[model samples]
Target chain A: MSIHNVIQVEGLTKKFGDFTAVNAISFKVEKGEIFGFLGANGAGKTTAMKMLIGISIPSSGKATVAGFDVFTHAESIKKSIGYMSQKFALYDDLTVKENITFFGGIYGLSRKRIRQKSAVLIEELGLEKVANKLVGALPLGWKQKLSFSVSMIHDPKIVFLDEPTGGVDPITRRQFWEMIYKAANQGITVFVTTHYMDEAEYCDRVSIMVNGKIEALDTPKKLKEQFKVANMNDVFLKLARG
Target chain B: MSICVANISKSYKNVKALQDISFNVKVGELFGIIGPDGAGKTTLFRILTTLLFADNGRATVSGWDVVSDYKNIRKSVGYMPGRFSLYQDLTVEENLQFFATIFGTTIEENYDLIKDIYVQIEPFKDRRAGKLSGGMKQKLALCCALIHKPKVLFLDEPTTGVDPVSRKEFWEMLKRLQQKNITILVSTPYMDEAALCDRIALIQDGKILEIDTPEAIVKHYPKPIYNVSANNMYKLINSLNAYQYIHSVYPFGEFVHYTDKRAEFNAVELKLYLESKNLSNIRIEKTVATIEDTFMELAK
Candidate 1:
């Protein structure tokens, strides 16, 4: 892990109307580390991601993503980071290559650069066969890979993935992680949220969110050890039950 | 009565869903139809419940042929679809009663069958199904499905969008439900859940990849699995994958789940190969493969 943090979140609080969606949570993602943001459904994981990505504002406290303030420097932070939500981010009706071009353009890439990046991204994701195919026609696994590749269109310093492999099969998920690993190898820090316990174990470190708070954070091995459990599932069970 | 499906094949417009899929569920058994999304599980479930007809072949649940005895099958089986299609405007209790009434039964008649699950959400009985949480909705749906006292139960990805704790609770409820002699045919994409079933059929791309008891499936795995990790973890995984003897390698947690070309290969030799590749801090250990591992092997 790098000494300098890519993401520094402290006492972060987010509220919607009257409900406190995320309560005073704190954590830091070191540059170049695949940081696992772990939580169950409605555990406020998505809410926290939205705040860190600058889509939703924090109710109080401070959060800087990719060395830019999430509140004041939102646009600059957005430029330095990539994000893939739990829901499909690509338009279903667009061709695979078209989705890539669209996202690249939205990120302010020049047409020439978008074309060049599109080719590299498509080739890396093995989407050459389906470049012209509608994203809806591609398998869920393939679309997830394409979505992840699209997130890094501008070669951002950080990427946020929200359950990137929700419904993908084991083989496809295994392959998806290969792409994540490829990105992490290139010094791109990954901030991903997932309910999948096994996927948590793949991260360099993980933070378990429950009821709008981060209850646990550590490497998967250490979390297992601290909980005296056999796997990440047991660790999650312990934290969730509490 | 046993449930049997023979040569079942169905397709939507221009897409073949099930292609000659065959399987059977023993009486009082908890059977699982395991597969990724769009692997024809829903179609098969619909065929067995007599809602949709197969383009070819036959299926019977509890001694009633789905085609010839459609009404009887509908009366005798419970189905929780992949998507929650319950009347959103209806209260939880209303939904339960509606399903029971449709099957020509009453909640009082089968109250004992669903008491445990129903009681969990009793306070919200007057709440609209759409207003309930994902876990509560699942509970209410299950109660409705069981209200008719069906001899068989078919749940399509019952734990799909729920929390982990609720998923565990749901599976526990199924175990208790099995005590009442109801055979279950459940479909799930999560391989970890596969072990809970009495038997599982691994499906992929509209084909039956494999079907057996979870234990049997794990025992049948042909490769000697090694989970190895090292510094420069990404490079280690890539290097191990690029090894001459590496048959199939995929990332599994902190380590790469690798199987060599030779069954007789040793972990020590594999470790040396990593060293030869100039990888440092390499730690390799032999590990027993889980259902997820077996599924990856089958699918790949």
Candidate 2:
């Protein structure tokens, strides 16, 4: 019930028939915080995210996103949050400008506001030259940036990014984190999942999931200290080995 | 040399995949080709494995020519491509048997070479390859590749989709294989894994930027870097970028990796500059360069 907490969950669980994909996990995310959700493949990170984002119903638990109950107000939660999946969600065939306008329209943005926002976004991302270019023709790094920008076109209160910088070079990954920092600075809660341990260090706090359960959750530094490891990667190895 | 490439160039239509790439791997050495996607690591692997011919180059694998002695090269090399190419419907045991039979060998004949990996997957021997978890599938793939006891093993992005724990275990297994005198050539986009290899080549835009040990690569970074942060990280990056005395600035996790234009950069002066801009909670300190920092410096 904390006013500062943008997301609150208690005993959130999901099951696929007899298989429990997400165990009774609980966590609270404060407004404008970058929350890192770390887990291995098939560790139920995606299923847990789906439940929090209001796309998947939990079998048993209490959850609230942006002050709305996940079960009763999933529609309102959807409108208040933006999501970028592991796969690029923008239309590849659409031009940079068109993709922006399209996503903005889907969020109930008016034509005038969409046009103004598109201009500012293109300029900010250094995409003015390729504003009319098809997204398919852009490099992977540029496409990722554009997709992230499009996701935030409506200025949602929370953004969920899944593996935003997969396969990108170090430089691009660094720049992408800047964008996340920028969003969080403007009071948007960012819930992200990534395999890269270095990215875990960027989070204000991180939760490591193992076998459908959250094995550890804390600031990266504290988790590293608790596990007697030098970095988040070693911390993950220690917890996952258990 | 266990493997060698000279003046290798490859292109498909209008796009250049590799440009004048050259490197050598010694006997029993673990060599890593590290780069992002579209960096031509796969193309280089395909050429050395004799699956694809290079447009211009001479190469050898285990002292056999990649082109003229391709058949001999194939016999001496184990290649696990980027994708899982095993029979999805087939069980783990069947896949191992199938690979061994194709190489004109039996599982029992080369069981010693794959005993460690095979034992882990043996409990699930009857499970379909596709039904196994990411880590289990990788173990099966490694076992299949080692059945014939090939002198050289080529693994393309073996740990890409696997979890961090499995990734650590995979590298440990590779170290054990190294003790067996197998020359391992692995490619991955992960910079952290580069440190695990004996020597690594950082590739980008189809060119090898640097080839050396991970420690040596980090030592080669020619600048004093600082980790800088403030309350407004986004504005801090922009202000740092616009600063007159800054050489380069890029975000690194929670802080920015910064280098000043002056050789003897003053951390206090940088802090004062941020304070002058009304930024609070400022923290700046000299930080050691990592393999990733070195890669970015070289790529730039």
Candidate 3:
């Protein structure tokens, strides 16, 4: 495998009993690339993502994440990647500082390193005034931003974001994408899934999954051209509806 | 008017959930409440549906006062909350039957009301509600909401987290339902869906920012907007934000929707400035403002 490829998969498949949730899917994610993984509801996106994040075992096929094999080095893969989902990221009862410290500890950061990182993160997000407040008390936009920062506390090689900007205001949503762009510029591979089609255009490459199989995979421009559509939303509607 | 809310205000301890909110929905019109989460949309829906009382002001639904005539309002209106409130353990058919029974009606009496939507999920009638897929569950929820054949329908963020195809299908169903003379008050965070409504009210932080047709709302934007693009999106945004003439810069799809602080701005000059910043392949074109752009400007 080339050193530039951070995530590599070959015919990766996941099945439950008689049902195949994720069919044989193969894709590569390059270093610092923003990859948008999109699909319709019940399209096995969650199943595929679970396998990539090392949380679930793949029933068949070969995959490597962050230079670690999915079958043999799952724990190492976990250590080399960060994950944040819209539903659950940070603890509501914990303060912003406490959430940071707790996640830092989970990633096995040194106490001194955690302290230094927490200071920088709090300042960067302008959360200094709310550092002591419970995460639940903060606005939805603030909590999502903080959750993303805490996910990167360990400085993993790749970060997985699941619908991170769902239901956010238009301004805050753009700010969130700006943060994503910054992370990518700093050489972190972003594997994100979102329901918003406009966000699909922001990715360097996007893969559309349908019925447990990948139906389309390319840059947003190429996908639009290939589908003979003006935008990603129409492209999505055509493929998913079919 | 099918629904009318006047000078409504509600508070929970320190948070003002809704403040002096007022709006009117014409009969048989598809009205939308467009806002993000915690914008007091659900609070307004609750008050109008008579599930919760406002600390001040009053509302009437289907010609009945929300408080004094809540019983009549509840009987004449259908409400689908944001969360899936159906019984998880019940089968789809059972759930539909239960709703029809409660409204003192039968499936045969109102089958025509939900025929198009219900037929899509009819094959899954035997499946448990909890086991249905996201799209199927939404269709089932809509079916339950319409089983009573009410004159008004209240849908709260029905398309939140739902995919594009299903969302499109859901909107089409709403348009068809409008022909039946049902006034629908739907709320969604998606600006794209706002255009599908006959009229929309943009709300934020316990207040209504603006209310008008989506076309009129976009025209309310005070400045010209431009679709600016370059080879490097990240660097392009930072450089434009650092420029002196920048009024607002927000990333929209493949390009950044930008506006200038000056009244008579030159695109060539701005392109030259970006070129000096080592950016290449710069493209700038005048673009129409969208509901999202108008919303951000109003919310700002």
iRMSD values, candidates in order = 1.4, 1.6, 0.6
How well is each residue in A91-133 modelled by candidate 3, as lDDT tens digits? Answer: 9999999999999999999999999999999999999899999
Q: TM-scores of the models, in the given order?
A: 0.96, 0.95, 0.99
Model 1's number of clashes is 0
Q: How would you encode candidate 3's per-residue C-alpha lDDT over B174-200 as one tens digit per residue? A: 999999999999999999999999999
Share of reference contacts kept by candidate 3 = 0.91
> Poorest 10 consecutive residues of model 2 chain A by lDDT?
A81-90
How high is the lDDT of residue B208 in model 1? 94
CAPRI class of candidate 1: medium
Per-prediction DockQ, in order? 0.67, 0.65, 0.92
Error of 1 at A87 (Å): 1.8
| Residue-level lDDT tens digits of model 1 in B1-300 | 479999999988888999999988899999988888778888888889898999999888888999899888888889999889899999988998899888888999989999999899999999999998888889988998888888999999999867678889999999999999999999998888899999999998889989999999999898889888888677887887678888988777777788889858877877788898888888888898988888878877
Estimate, for each residue in A113-221, the C-alpha lDDT of model 1 and write its tens digit. Answer: 9999999888877778889999998888888888888999999999999888877888888788888888888899998877688888889999998899999999998
lDDT of each candidate versus the true structure: 0.87, 0.91, 0.95
TM-score of chain B of each: 0.95, 0.97, 0.99
lDDT of 1 at B205: 83
